[model samples]
Target: MKWTEVQEIAIQLSERHPETDPAKVNFVDLMKWTMALPEFDDDPKHCGERVLEAIQQAWIDEVA
Candidate 1:
């Protein structure tokens, strides 16, 4: 997805999960955390993939 779409999803997630620490909600940090997940460790493009998945999942979980 486009960076703009990713950002929009992140914002939606943040709004839904208001208890999450605001300091921890920025795009770069979230992408870093997602990339560190073990499941993506072997993927050569893990950083970008994880960032996209993280944003999407965050948005989904926010509403569920």
Candidate 2:
């Protein structure tokens, strides 16, 4: 998934790391985990703080 697919990525992340808390994740780790997803295919350069923040928020919402 691309960086634009924020919600999908968040869902995947939440599932991949059920024990982890999105709110406690730093952008560096968040970006790394996002890139590690098997379905993720976007360029690393395409991701930014805004996109990471959106993914983090979505992940938090997914768990909540």
Candidate 3:
């Protein structure tokens, strides 16, 4: 999945990190975790602050 797949990424992240809280995640960790996904395929440089924020927000929403 690409950076555009924010919701999907968030869902996967939430599922993988059930013990962690989304709001507590920093962008650096977020980036690392997202990149670690087997389905994730994209340039790391494509992840800007806005995209990271969107992913984090989606993750928070997903957990809620």
Provide TM-scores for the models.
Answer: 0.35, 0.97, 0.98
lDDT of each: 0.53, 0.96, 0.97
What value of lDDT does candidate 2 attain over all alpha carbons? 0.96
Candidate 3, residue 26: lDDT: 95
- Ranking of all predicted structures according to TM-score, beginning with the best and ending with the worst: 3, 2, 1
Candidate 1 structure quality by residue, lDDT tens digits, 1-64: 3333555555654664556764445656666544444332334244464656667665556555
State the TM-score for model 2: 0.97
Could you arrange the candidates by lDDT from highest to lowest? 3, 2, 1
lDDT winner among the candidates? 3
Error of 3 at 9 (Å): 0.3
lDDT of the structure predicted as candidate 1: 0.53
Off by over 4 Å in 1: 1-24, 41-64
For candidate 2, lDDT tens digit of each residue in 1-64? 8999999999999999999989999999999999999999989999999999999999999999
lDDT string for model 3 (1-64, tens) is: 9999999999999999999999999999999999999999999999999999999999999999
lDDT of 3: 0.97
